[model samples]
Target chain A: MKDKKPMKSVFKAGAITSEFIGNSIYKHQTKTSIGAHNIFLGQVRADDIKGKTVSAIEYTAYEDMANQKFHEVRESAFEKFDLTCMHIYHSLGTVKAGEICLFVFVSSPRRKVVFEALEFIVEAIKADVPVFGKEIFEDESHQWKLNS
Target chain B: MLITIKYFGQIAEVTQKEEEQLEVSKGSVSGLLNTLNTKYSDLKNKDFQIAQNQELVDLDTELTGAEIALLPPFAGG
Candidate 1:
């Protein structure tokens, strides 16, 4: 079935907790039409830049445009794949290293559709969405993060 | 024409503010950039793309929309 949900704000103020993620999974049990569920979680990495280490990432976005892009991505995914439901959540404020910053859940009637849809959505977000991240170093310095 | 400009990420740091409205002559995207680059001198050194009405537009595109955004490289996941 085609999903015709309205545009939603995918941003959360802080890091996404495992409890929230687990609860999300728990909430989907009643949707027995979904035979497979695929998830993609983007965690903040403690990357070493030269001599310093990244401690956290503070995210910001062009909110209106980002939400619009997310809507377009979701719509296209539904058109391309047979999915039961899909959800996307991204961190807005500071997220510590090793914490989840993005959670994308896609459920479908088959395993292949979920896998393909999840990848398409994630890649589209990385390339098209106008979300910025400031990587704060352990020493208190910061640098803008660029998706590579 | 008066246009509202939004600066994001590194572009905002150069502009020192996130949003501003400017009175500009009827022109193209590059014309608006020329004005901004003059207003915020450091803007030329930074890398960014331009969006008109939330959609990316080339510099040669005519200035048709009132809202323009200077977007630095996206880092979303």
Candidate 2:
């Protein structure tokens, strides 16, 4: 039987605050079944290209397709691992350097499961999602970012 | 048929608009791309993928008059 997981909105405007991430972890305390939780946070890097330095990243996506892809990744993670729950959040607008742009959280009953599942989910997200980033230089010029 | 085409990120930057409606002849994805290429000269130099009905499709796939999108390289983490 196919896993029928409900779709959740993963896009957030601007940068994801540290307080929000802390709150998310605090809330999961009530889930007593979850013994291990692995979190991955993607920060905007201030890359220096030539003489210009990157100040921020402006993110955009094909929302309908991106949400669908996120759903598929979640389902596949569940199928491959004994995951208790998973949550993914990505920024939509401008995220300044050193700020969090993406957050992926996975919970499981065992430490080993969380480790493997976290890497799988993060890799899948980078490879599969249709999210785009425009790296803005300090001089106000921008260039498109590609996954390496 | 009239097809709604969506553009995102750098692809939208090249098109100078987010979405537009175009009248296309019965053709394959490559044919539609040719029409778009002729209409927007800047599009030819840009790198992107075509999605039909929200799914990534190859150049040889036939157009089904669905919602189409021009997507640039993904940078999401």
Instruction: Give the alpha carbon lDDT tens digit for every residue of A1-148 in model 1.
Output: 6456888799999999999999999999988888999999999999999989999999999999999999999999988999999999999989999999999999988999998999999999999999999999999989999999
Q: Which candidate is the best by TM-score?
A: 1
TM-score for candidate 2: 0.97
Per-residue lDDT tens digits of candidate 2, residues A1-148?
2224589889999999999999999998988888999999999999999989999999999999999999999999999999988889999999999999999999987899999999999999999899999999998999999899
| TM-scores, each model vs. reference | 0.98, 0.97
lDDT of 2 by residue, B1-77 (tens): 99999999988988899999999999899999999998889999999999999999999999999999999989998
Lowest lDDT 10-residue stretch of candidate 2 chain A: A1-10
lDDT of each: 0.93, 0.93
Clash pairs, candidate 1, are none
Q: What is the interface RMSD of each candidate, in Å?
A: 0.5, 0.7
Q: For candidate 1, give fnat to 2 decimals.
A: 0.87
Query: Candidate 2: misplaced stretches above 4 Å?
Result: A1-5
